[model samples]
Target: MATNAQLGADDDYIVVRNPSKLADLLTARNVDPEVVTKYLHIIRGDAKDCYTVGKTLYGINLEIADMVVSDVGGSTVVKPNRLRPTLDDPTICQDVVSNIPNSLKRIELLFKATPRTRRKPYIVVISTTGISNHGRDIAVAMDKKAMEGILLREIQTGGRGASVIRGFTAVRPSFLTDGKPVGAQKIRAAVEEEGKVAKSAIGYTISRGDVGAWIYEELVEDNAAGELKYVN
Candidate 1:
């Protein structure tokens, strides 16, 4: 239950102990000068703790020294650190249900248990088409079946789960493939409309890398807040 302020004061000495060396290492990595400066500033700030840097900051642990990255569904996901439930990071509560359980109740518990101040915006990925509407397409049908019952429901409308969080940006993309990034030119974002899939959100297959890149750009870098964006 250590506050960010307390963690910062206690950890500053580790980084401040050798700023010049750290700067040299960052410079060697060819990291942007501005990014390096910002990191240094944060390291010296009143809350000199290293909180999460990517997408959402809610489930990240600042105490870890190394940056954490994960390969999820063929996409590389980067987070400032990992969340260790009940140990260092009590803010996160995760559970995997094998058989049928009270999903709503479970989700509700996770939502209500987390402190309001600790909540952060969520970046969710979903299918552009739903099974009920696009059941003809095998991929869309499978996606809908897999996501509709749990992830989509909780994120889109589950009471405290989505409604109580700081904010959420739901990205619904078309079929995904492993290829080069499509870049911004081929990508588009629009407000979600039921039973009406736009041309940009249909008959297109985007690279997994491109999807990850878009999430990083819109959610992490641009800090794009609320709204559901359909991309392809």
Candidate 2:
């Protein structure tokens, strides 16, 4: 999702990205400088105090966040992205899950710290499309290792360990195409149950922009994608 869009609009965000191209990134996203000051808290790795624009970093930071999003997968940890996965290299199926042990604890604390209010925050993630045996019948189990890793993040994060921070939703899309948004209504979304997201059998592929629209509908427009509890 674009930072200038409703994805980051009027919301306090912990923006973590390659800080070297910070200006170009914002320009590409069409975000104004003022918008950066109004809502974003960038985690500038290494360049000490170069961009300490936000006041808070650790304390109560995760707690107040409106959403906990994880876009990383198995390929996230693999270095030198030029090469494909090899059968010999183990731990390829769960790079993100394995590295997020500390983050899991932090997520739990965020859930626990949730205020006694009507609205609750959500944890959303991008999982692979082959998890429920619905998409790409040809891809072998070994090839879908990244998908497996991503699905693990969704399921594990939805468990009692996190304990009611908000609803959790996982979008397991097939090959992502780049183009104009296909619109969320065009998506044949998988049925969401208590703690499960059934795979969509009919849909073979979805555009990245469509995925963003789907997320906006789920998170912003209240067409939520999972079990929810709106307390009074």
Which is the leading candidate under TM-score?
A: 2
Which 10-residue window of candidate 2 scores lowest in summed lDDT?
A: 47-56
Expressed as tens digits, the lDDT of each residue in 55-164 for candidate 1 is 11222342211111112122323356633212232111112110112322333355565444333323343443444452342243223334324434444575544443
For each candidate in turn, the TM-score is: 0.42, 0.56
Worst 10 residues of 1 by lDDT: 91-100
Model 1 RMSD in angstroms: 12.6
Which candidate leads the pack in lDDT?
Answer: 2
Give the TM-score (vs. native) of candidate 1. 0.42
Which stretches of model 2 miss by more than 4 angstroms? Answer: 1-11, 15-17, 45-64, 74-101, 104-121, 133-167, 192-201, 220-232
Residue 51 C-alpha lDDT in model 2: 26
